[model samples]
Target: MLMMFWQLTIDANDPARLARFWGQVLGYQPAPPESDTTWWAHYRGRLGGRDAFDDRIFDPDGRKPPLWFQEVPESKAGKNRLHLDLYPTARDDSLPYDRRVEIVDAKVAELVELGANVRRRERGDSYYFVVMHDPEGNEFCVS
Candidate 1:
C-alpha cells in the first residue's frame, strides 16, 4: 500500500493560539462541532484532497495525529532544521518581479502583526521571499 502525506505537526507552547493563527493564515476553518481539549481544524484544497490539512491543538498529553500541536516545557532555540515555504497560489507569469515583491511585502506586514517576526528578506530578478518566525520562534518562509 502507498502511504500519503497526512499533515505537518508543530510543537508549540501555546497550542490553541498557534493553531488559530495558522488556521487564519491558511484560510482554514476550525473542525466542525468541536470537542473539548482537542482543538481541530482543516484546510480544503486541491493538492491532496478536499481536506488536505488536518491540524489539531492538544494538551501536553500525547494523542491523535495529523498536525498535532502539543504543549512543551522547554522553549525552541536556535535555527529550525525544518521549515515551511509558501507561495502565491494565484501567481501568473504575467506579473513583474517588482509587483510580486510588493504583494509579498504586504503579506509580511500582516503576518508580523499576527505574531510573526521577520528574520530575513531576499529578492531576486524573478522572485522574493521572507523568512519569519512564529510566536514560538519556529521559522517559516513566505514567497
Candidate 2:
C-alpha cells in the first residue's frame, strides 16, 4: 500500500474569504470542479450557517498540494499549533542573511498590502525572518 499527500485543511470563520486571501498569497487558483458542478453550486447546498463555505485552492500548475478552508463557528483563540514558513526564495535557504532579509522585507511589504499584519521581526546570529498573521489571525513566517 502507498500513501499520498492530498490537502491541508485550515479552520476559518469564513472559509471562502480565507481561501481568496490565501489564493492571492500563494498564487494559487480555485480548485476546478470535480464533475459538472461549480464550486459554489456544490457547496451552496451544504452551507448550514457557520459551518458552510468550505473552499479549496490549488496550484495552477498542479505541482503543489491543495489547501482547504473549512468554516467553523468559533473564532481563532490563540497561536497556531503549526504555521507555514514562506521563504522568498521559495525553497532555497542558502542565501546570506542580509540578502534573505532584503527578500523577506519585500515579500512582507507585499503581504502587508494584502492584509497580513506583521507581528514582529526577528534577527538571529545568522538568520532573519518576519512573523506575520493572516487576516484571520493565523500566524506564518517569511524569510
Q: Candidate 1 on 55-143: residue-level lDDT in tens?
A: 45222222333355678887898888898776752565577777788778899898998888999998777768899988888999998
All predictions: root-mean-square deviation over Cα?
Answer: 9.0, 5.2
Model 1 per-residue lDDT at 125: 74
Return the lDDT, model 2, position 57.
Answer: 79
State TM-scores per candidate: 0.70, 0.79
lDDT of 2 by residue, 20-101 (tens): 8889999977654333334344443555544423387777666577788988999999889989889876656677667777
Number of clashing residue pairs, candidate 2:
0
Please give the distance, in angstroms, between residue 86's alpha carbon in candidate 2 and its true position after superposition: 0.2
Looking at model 1, which ten-residue stretch has the lowest summed lDDT?
Answer: 38-47
In candidate 1, stretches whose alpha carbon ends up further than 4 angstroms from where it belongs are 1-5, 32-66, 89-91
Candidate 2 — which residues are off by over 4 angstroms?
A: 33-54, 91-94
lDDT (Cα atoms) of all candidates against the true structure: 0.66, 0.79
